[model samples]
Target: MPDGGPVIVGISRSTEKIREIVRKVADVDLNVLISGESGVGKELVARSLHYFSSRKKRPFIKVNCAALPGELIETELFGYEKGAFTGADKQKMGKFEAAADGSIFLDEIGEIPMSMQAKLLQVLQDQKFPRIGGHKEIDARARVIAATNRNLEAEILSGNFREDLYFRINTISIVVPPLRERPEDVEPLVYYFLDRLSKEHRLPKPDISPRLMKLLKGYHWPGNVRELENYLKRLLVLGESKELEAELEAAGDGWNSETDTASSQEAVIEEAAKEVLPNKNSREKQFPSLKEVRDKAVYRVERALIKQVLEETNWNRREAAKILKISYRALLYKLKDMNLTPH
Candidate 1:
């Protein structure tokens, strides 16, 4: 937050210490292991490291070890010679080769199969590996950065992750705390996304109401920064052209239509809506869409916002519901109603 270094989000002493560690790690070429939850933006840390390192001008390759098939993990990491396999019609450089004199971020490293761990270990140990079905050796001059959400120590104990590989790639470890632990960041992150979306879409600046901020501050974020970004994206899209007055009206109508049948439900929704939404004229057609399209748009916006917040908050339904100013059960219903992605 000073001297144009980087934006460090979070309040705890541990987070501050971790931020310092990350900044120091980013300044070197040493092996870095970024550990965090799925949506905590480990890749962001990896990118930051590459940018901060001397190798910033060189390649910065990111490989999703978790998504790669176990059969091809070796080839993907170490490259393949021409005709090495049925699909190896041409010579293909592995991530390490592509990242020569650069950085390679092996994401979701914990999901790498045990069979391939030794080969990975060898590359880290020897800085070289033979392309698949080739006799000639390929040097791996790239710096290694690995990320994972899993507990590698537990995996090593379980014989799933190689101890040597673990020790090799984790020369420096940086744990990114989840968003729930950094409530202070929620407000700024929401504003950041709002700004980003505004510029990206060439729309006017968007806003998150004070009531919404209060609601956001009280909620737990299981998914972390990634989730928060997604919600802001949806909010920007939903409110880009609509006045602040419009969103409140829409939320009000949404609350009314969903709960009009039961008097008790109406009271609950009304109370929460009033508490969370800014006071505005409900009679105005500020969003420029009628009942049907507006309702659908709200559903889309709500689903996107809720799912992103959940992802940012680490899928904690309770926390997500609180941010949305709804009950946990109501959030579930909305998610189901919108056919939203679970994670």
Candidate 2:
């Protein structure tokens, strides 16, 4: 991570690549499209771009496109004159005008309605737009950095997103990989979150046992770094608990749970513990060595994660590789080693 900017704490190759891309393009005034799963720190990347850019002194406006209704989007971005609508009472500055020479981040860019997409495209192309119910055109000088979780190419093919608009906002694209694909970054992220969250909450950092740390690194984080941070927050508030250990153990057991399900964490963790944890009652049973257990667990989780990513990408190895943050050749080697194929 660079100084005086959003700190993307990671030693993983993927994190370094993101840092490299930010350094190279931070000063370049081009639209950057950052695509990743929700809570994967897309906004952090956007902020880092703005912080390091030439427009660092100017405003950095953020508009959640998904949060705005279709009817109000146009007026929201370009602003409106007094009495432009029924609720209009006074002159208002639009995001573009307010952004000035800074950057305007359009979060969830794919959710913008088709009608509004054309208008946005025009603004990006012409570098100027008019206020609603006003003739005066304002220059759109802000750098545009858009992010989306949706597959915009699919949206375009389905006639929901404008291809021209896609090209306009996607002059440079950066893909932030999910946490499961970058387990190496887990330790640093855990420490970083612990330190920050402790200071924020005025609590001392709790000692994380090596066993628990191993579980955290091995677990497949469904919510990515956001999920990790939340878990750390709970840890900070509640200290280490058996419940938390069980929940993390479930992820290590190869459960691909969705982030939306609250109960899934408990259910799967309980089930996984029953299956994987050694039973104390079996006196005659010879348990596997710790090394064997760890190797097997890693193999199982890695296979499941790779398969899931590949399936999500519809067997597009290149896309899967990008999402996995591994080189194309490395992904090929892994596929071969793991004996994985398109389902």
Candidate 3:
């Protein structure tokens, strides 16, 4: 992501098609729905739409409905009157009001509860909504741009989502393909992340090795652009260490090992070993010491356990530390050492 511009960085056909859509539909005052796999940059597309729109000067409010409960989401979107809730100390404007005459991006819109969907639909249809516990109705003037990774049509069929609300928000749809579908995008993304992360870390950008680039392009990134970005951040910090290579190989193996046979597993290990090990015919072949092997094994196991605990706790470091029976400071140190950042 460049400094003040939309994060669409690829020149692939799919990416070009997205640019075309943004150019045509932006400023049209029609609601748009962006669909894609997680981390495929759906929010980037939404921002691009908002950026090119007539309301670019106004606030571009973003709401992640999935991050809050149903009751809280309603209050967050429509606001609540002072003293309406137990903690209500002031009458604050909600996201819709904050986005007045601009764009409101509803991320993870599929995760919105069904009951709230009806209220959302009513607001969208009427272009007005009252704050919670208030009789005065405020104009809903924001352009709605919703993004979802789920199959919303399937969700509607299953009665988890309102069909009317889906139709209301999805006047035009933009689907961002996963990175694996557009591998050409990976190169630019790598360079972009490298430059961006290097600047953020205040580190000189290290030259990316051809072998590392090859590994990056060849590996199937199930986590999409976000995953690639995190790996590049790691590279910036770690400078392509053996541990990083092992982690990448392990992640790739796990992704593909669902149907792998015993022989295939051995083949993967052999290939990984070849990458690290000296040529067999070399007279100066060196082997890792017993302590070195032990340390590496411990590091891998610890990293996996810590990662699993972090994910299970939704990356809440304090909760993860409690679950892992480690001190918060210790966990933070491990995370920094392992370059284990949240995705």
Candidate 4:
């Protein structure tokens, strides 16, 4: 049977191609890898797959790999016998077992440790996984849909991820388009969030002047849908015109954090610069040969600096934007572009 789900908000060859693939894959028990940058709604695609699949009525369990400690993820997923470890006073059913006849969604799958990747691989290949401290292999028949924002191929190359596990989970891959790639969806999303946020905040629905709509579409959404949704929710609460203006600047792909006249541009910039280009050596340090390593390291310093500056400025995005010497709108764009949280 074809997917009877609602048509996704926007329509285009790209989105249609995705729909086409889902229609084909919905009935199969393949291990699917849903890939995209942060906030691109990979989880939406996963839910759609489960709803349209043969097991629609079964459980849809979500496991956020990044939300747990690396030491405990395996037991969390594969279960353990009574007394498996320090806290295992009783036998436990892990995520895989809990969703036995349904589907399991593993979000941020790339965050799984290298050692555990092999266990996941065995489960995918053989349809079986043993309890952490138990003797017998249990029937692990649930369909697996895993999502990740990181490039696992890069992780594999860096030896931080397993190649075999990548091949296993990536048996079928679906890449969700970023918000910037689908401008047609913006208006609908704004309307959707505005109304819902208004209701949630117990406020009157906002009248987004046509001018504001234009400004929003003109900006690039680096944080994807989540950023847009969050911004609109804040608007319903604050009801400040500046929130709308700040969102416009954010859409412009800038990293401005200044929210008022009192914001100190010089102070924000000096702190931001130091945070991003930290004196790792306080002298000279030999750089790595791999571009990914270098990029990851640069991103490391950049993220740390951004986080610190945002904290110091109390998340006054407009002022932070001014400090960065970019339009407040531009700063919003860059923060999203960097897939980073703003200060």
Candidate 5:
């Protein structure tokens, strides 16, 4: 590792092991693949690799492969000439060019479309690619670090991903375990978030009650660290432990239950709504009906849970259905009912 310590936070064995691997490979220029669920800080690990390496002084550019549309990904990665496309106003430099002699972090690499996979493979193999509408090949001097929540092996077996490209990027792989799997890091992360949020917001650091801490540790964070951070910020802003407790109680223990049936899921949602929402006419008769409020709460909770499971399964609806213990048709119906579509 470099003079400064690792950028990753946490004292869990899994996190420490990841740091050990990073230290061993930081100086070497081999391509790296990081696999983890969404919001598990894959980008942070990628940054640590670049910062601790010899190329710390150079540019550290990042590209979100999932954010760009399929039609524009190639041009975004390889740049374009002034007259390359319909609206080519001026010369544009892509991520590879901006990251010269440094590192380029490709987040959500599995989302890249099949049409552009071969081009990306060429750049990985040859370290050079021609810009759109330009014959001259540009040298790729940056180290490539790719991360994805998807299982590329399954994708390859299904023919959704290229096998050769998988080998090229899997030179060194790091798997970041989920937060629920490592309970020891929960308290450290809570304090870390509290300190950071307090400093940023210029607020005094509030002490966490043992009860709150216990509930936090007990809950299965489907959204991982990002979700925990958001929840902490909410707690700080609201300054109400009772509200947090009520919501958690309403959410129930179905999150960890392996035998969650349809009726049980519905009952859990109803119980959560009653606990979290105030009864109608409690606030001088300006509130929505109790049924409407319950419906809304149930919708929000269901949407969140479904979305979390989808992310955990890498957007594989069939797999998600199996985990959720719902039929494929029912899952599709619920998605449509909630107006939730995969990005």
Candidate 6:
């Protein structure tokens, strides 16, 4: 198999086919569209295309269309001259300019606003676009590779996405199968994550018994490889084989076992919460307001979840966004808001 790229890992036939397509498409400059469910590793395939292409030595830029605010989308893609906007104090190079003579991966392409679609199409059609506040046109020498989890056909029918832009970027399309559809790759992926994550965290790798591996393969991973990777990370963090054993038993016997484990999990959570939040008795006579308490709790959980997901994906925000089922832009905002920097 072509192996897609260093980041792509799987032994399934479906995976092999995707890798082959990526290898073939990488050699060409045609705009390529990658279609897959969120967390199915569309960006990895995009990276693979860039990694194997002739432009490998050049910059490989990525822009998440869904993450860019509607008002800023144009300026973000095309450079803006000084005084173009309130914050445009100086001329800034956009993603396209930065990606000159290389490849640009536009993720969540379906979420691009309709108003910006025509401008994007213009660039694709003419390979030239003017800066936000400049009269001169700048040539876009970068090859475009776009990926989306949405059904563009449906978006076109609903008039949400432009058919012209779709055709422009869809010169070649590659669809990555979801994890459930590629069961044969599950075991290999499990071990891969185990080894990588173990080395990453400087922890001992845990052994997965055949029965546990079977249980893992049988489960429907709605979140795809990302979800599997997160699960492995959780296991490593908890340092408990019994947790997976309990989960597998629950899967086999249904809700009864889960109900039994829920209490123990809840106790652990409560203890952790208490450590983070001061005890009521230990607080001063005046208690904190309800809103303050709620806000603190929310902040703690949100920060923790974001940090955990980031660790699992090795700080790949795009994959973390897919697993969290949020826009890539939103994830960035949260990281900023929560001040949760990757360690």
The prediction achieving the highest lDDT against the true structure is 2
| Candidate 3 structure quality by residue, lDDT tens digits, 15-34 | 98998999999989999999
Candidate 5 ranges beyond 4 A from true positions: 1-6, 259-343
TM-score for candidate 6, residues paired by index: 0.71
What does the lDDT read for residue 284 in candidate 4?
70
The ten-residue window of minimal lDDT in model 3 covers 259-268
lDDT of 5 by residue, 85-148 (tens): 8899898888999899999998989999988898899888999988888888899989989999
* Per-model lDDT: 0.75, 0.88, 0.87, 0.79, 0.86, 0.85
Give the per-residue lDDT digits (tens) of candidate 4, residues 1-343: 2255544555656677888888899889998999998998788788888888988889989999999877689988998999878888999999999998899999999999877888788888888878988989888888999999999989988998998888888999999888877887788888877766776678998778777787777666779888888877777777758667865766464433332312454455555555545467667765445765567656665555555566778888887766667788876776887776641
Span of ten consecutive residues with least summed lDDT in model 1: 1-10
- Expressed as tens digits, the lDDT of each residue in 1-343 for candidate 2 is 3355679889999999999999999999989999999888899999999998889989999999999999788888999999988888988889999999999999999999989998898889899988998889999999999999999999999999999999999999999999878989999999999998898899999999999999998887779899999999999999879999988887666564454334544454455445565787998877988887677666666666778778878999999999889999999999999999874
Better of 2 and 6 by TM-score: 2
Clashes of 2: 0
TM-score of each: 0.66, 0.74, 0.72, 0.69, 0.73, 0.71
After TM-score superposition, what is the CA distance of residue 177 in candidate 2 from its true location, in Å?
0.6
**Against the true structure, candidate 5 has what lDDT?**
0.86
* Model 1 lDDT tens row, 216-294: 5654445668766775676666764345435445554454444444655445445544444434767753443366555
- Per-prediction count of colliding residue pairs? 9, 0, 0, 31, 0, 0
- TM-score of candidate 1 relative to the true fold: 0.66
TM-score: the better of candidates 3 and 4: 3
Worst 10-residue lDDT window, candidate 4: 254-263
User: Which sequence of candidate numbers ranks them by TM-score, best first?
Assistant: 2, 5, 3, 6, 4, 1
